[model samples]
Target: MTSPLLVGFLASFALIAAIGAQNAFVLRQGIRREHVLVVVSVCAVSDLLLITAGIAGIGAVITAHPQMVTVAKIGGAGFLFIYGALAARRAMKPSTLAPAQNGSARLISVVLTCLTMTFLNPHVYLDTVVLLGTLANQHADSRWLFGIGAVTASVVWFFSLGFGARCLSGLFAAPMTWRILDGLIAVTMIGLGISLVVS
Candidate 1:
């Protein structure tokens, strides 16, 4: 028989491992080696709070208020579209494609972007609150332990994605590589934004 903790860990990891706007942003920052700790911390802590809220039954509250999700979808879509356009522009400019030449974003800007990427996406709510919470509650008396397991998965994934990206510095040394990355990011952000609006 599967333990609640293991179930939670596996479930949470599977949900977040997908490439999304949040993950794309984290990957870029990790490649740049800029504000990686801040980005990782924000994502992990946000997951911690969200997973806790889910286990505490806030998922039910959110379910009762469908408008909240709608609002997030619209706002997140707009944000992603703009970010995607910027990334596309960057990808087109070879001068801006080099990691060393690409200037670092201000600390405040990184924090805000990270927060926006985390909280503005309705999918985050659906995954962490609705899905994870529902999964945790299925374990009955062991629900909190399930939640702890989920939170651990989140912490581990974000840190690994954020820091592990640094090892790719050698690969990203080429401006062409950065172009390909930014181009992919642009496509991903725009594609996700469009999906959010229609879905």
Candidate 2:
């Protein structure tokens, strides 16, 4: 039999390892090596907090009242659409891929933006609260342990993405590389937004 911890870890990782808006933003910040630690910390901590809430039974409350999900869905879709457009514009622009010596934004701004991406996204709630929580509860005797496993996966993934991106700094030095990345980000965000609205 598969361990609850392993199941949780795999499930959480599978849900999160996609090319979503948050991941794209994290990847960009990582490549720039700008506030990488802060970004990773915020993402991981957010996951821990959400997962804890889910395991603590908030998941049941959310599942019982789906209006919350509907509200989140609408707001998240708008946000994703706007963000996607901006990314597309950036991709179309012939901007250099090099990070400015001072970086584009303040660390606080980056943190705030990251927070918006984390909290405002409906999928985050659906995946963490409803899906993961339900899965953990299925383990019954080991639900909390399952949650810990899921949280650990989050910690690992964020830190790896945030830090490991620097290794590709050389590749991202070319304008075309950034263009490609931003283009893909645009498509991903837009596609996800539409799906969220329609689904």
Candidate 3:
């Protein structure tokens, strides 16, 4: 039998795995190996809070207020489009291939950027609060367990993405690697932005 915990873990992992603004920023920070602990902590905690809210019926509240979703969509779409353009610009630049270790942005700047990316993105709310929350409600008996599982997934993913990314240092040593990554990020962000606006 498929346990609610397992269902939550798998479902959350699947949705979270999608390449979005948060993931991109996380990946970048992971690659740069700067303030990773802080970054990962923020993401995991943010997800936990959002997931808890979802399980607690915030999803329904959100559904009842379509205006909130609309605001999120507009804000998210705008942020995503701008982020994508920045990625696209980076992809065009040849200097991106160089080691960014010393060039890492200030901790405060990075954290604020991370916060903006996390809070401003509406999909996070929809996915964690609405979709996952609704799915957990289906299990009624073990909804909290399901939330725990989802929370676990977030913890594992962020930590792994942040720490394990160092393993890719060799592969990403080349400039082409950065180009490819930024290119994909750019395309993904733009596509998501357009989707939000149109949908």
Candidate 4:
């Protein structure tokens, strides 16, 4: 039998490793070297809190209120669609890829966008709160350990994604490459948005 800690780590890793809006956004920021620390911190901390909440049984509360899920889905979809449109525009008017842009964005805006990406996405709740929580509870006495393991995976993954993206800096130096990446991000966000609404 798999240990609960290992189970939790692997489960969380699998869910988060998939390409999605959050990951794409992180990669973009990481490449740009813009607020990478803030982005990574927000994502890691948010995951920690959500995972802890799930283990502490907050998942049940979320589940009990189905309307909450609907609200999140609609709101998340709208945000994602708008974000996607913005990305599409960026792709169309490709800008030179630089480590830092001419003028950096405000810290507040970056934080707010990161929060929206984390909290608004309904899938995040489903994966971290419901699925992970349910799995952790299956461990019975070892549930907290499972939660810790899951949180560890989240922290590790985000830091790696956020920092590791710099290795691709050389590749993204070309304006066309930046355009392609933005285009891909746009597709991913819009695709996820559509799925959230239809599902």
Candidate 5:
């Protein structure tokens, strides 16, 4: 029998494997070891919501609304482009010393940054809610199973990203590392944006 848990786990991991702004931000936080839990929680919760929405038949509505999708795409594309540019610029600038302790403020900032990165990028909705939803429906035995799998995936992904990034921090510490990451982000954002506009 096909285990919903297994399906969900694999699907979620597969989807998140594609590196994006969220992943980038998560990695940075992991390296810094700052507010990691808060960031992961926000990302996990956001994914859960999106995945639920997808499995609840909202995916069809989104797919049917090409106009709405187009608008979202344009907005997402623009946001990504600007965000990428900013990351690149920051990479070019000299790194500043780490800020003094402020746990409350840091936590809030992590949550908000994650929320903005996830919510503002309409592509996230499309990918998690619409695409994943449609895919789940195809494989799910029932709606409940779909939801179960989807949520499970979110939990697994967030924890993995939050902790796993720390393992690679050493490699990412090099000055050239930030430049490479920033450049990749910029290219990805621009490419995605242009693709959305053209399509």
Candidate 6:
């Protein structure tokens, strides 16, 4: 018999594996080795909440509301296009972000940045909450197990990204590297947004 917990974990991991802005930020922070714990904690917690909500049947409501989904799709796509443009713009400019002066500022920045990266992207909710949640329901003998699996996946992924990026920090230190990363981010975001809108 397939355990709901295992299924949920695999499903959650599968959903999060997509390369998106949130993952990008997590990787960048990991590379910088700045507030990696804070970033990972926030992201993991946020995912936990969303996944739990989905397992609790929030996804059913979302699925039932076609109009709401349409509205969300539009809003999300628009936000992505704008965010992509901004990233592209930042890539063009010379980076002037000084290191955080203190631990408090660093913590705050991590929270805010993670929040922006996670919440600002509509795809997160769609994939993790709505889509994954809906799928989990199909095999839900015990919904809580699914939620646990989903949360576990979030924790593992965030930690890996936060710590793993450190291994590649040296490669990304150059200005050209930043530009390329930002450029890719911009293009990816815009492409995703347009695709969402058209489809």
User: What ranges in model 1 sit over 4 Å off?
Assistant: none
Ranking by TM-score: 1, 4, 2, 3, 6, 5
Report the candidate with higher TM-score, 2 versus 3: 2
Q: Where does candidate 2 have its weakest 10-residue lDDT segment?
A: 94-103
Q: Report the backbone clash tally of model 1.
A: 0
Question: Which of 4 and 6 is ahead in TM-score?
Answer: 4
Candidate 2, number of clashes: 0
Q: lDDT per residue, candidate 1, 1-199, as tens digits?
A: 7988999999999999999999999998998899999999999999999999999999999999989999999999999999999899999998887657867779999999999998999999999999999999999999998998899999899999999999998899998999999999999999999999999
Model 6, span 155-194: residue lDDT tens:
9999998999888877776767767877887898898888
User: Over 4 Å off in model 5, which ranges?
Assistant: 96-106, 138-141
lDDT of 1 at 158: 94
Q: Considering lDDT, which of the candidate structures 1 and 2 is the better prediction for this target?
A: 1
**Cα TM-score per model:** 0.97, 0.93, 0.90, 0.95, 0.82, 0.83
As for candidate 4, its clashing pairs are none
lDDT of each: 0.93, 0.88, 0.87, 0.90, 0.73, 0.78
TM-score of 6: 0.83
lDDT of 4 by residue, 108-191 (tens): 998899999999999888889988999999899999989888999999999999999999988987888888998898899999
Assess the local accuracy of residue 95 in candidate 3 as a C-alpha lDDT between 0 and 100.
79
Q: List model 5 lDDT by residue over 1-199, tens digit each.
A: 6776677667777777687778877876776677888888888888888888888888888788867777777777787777767766756754621222212335766787788778866677778888778777877566557667777777777778888878876776676775676677667767766776777
lDDT of 3 by residue, 41-67 (tens): 999999999999999999999999989
Better by lDDT, candidate 6 or 4 = 4
- Rank order by lDDT, top first? 1, 4, 2, 3, 6, 5
CA deviation > 4 Å runs, candidate 2: none
Q: Compare the candidates by lDDT and give the number of the best one.
A: 1
Candidate 3 stretches with Cα past 4 Å from truth are none
Better of 1 and 5 by TM-score: 1
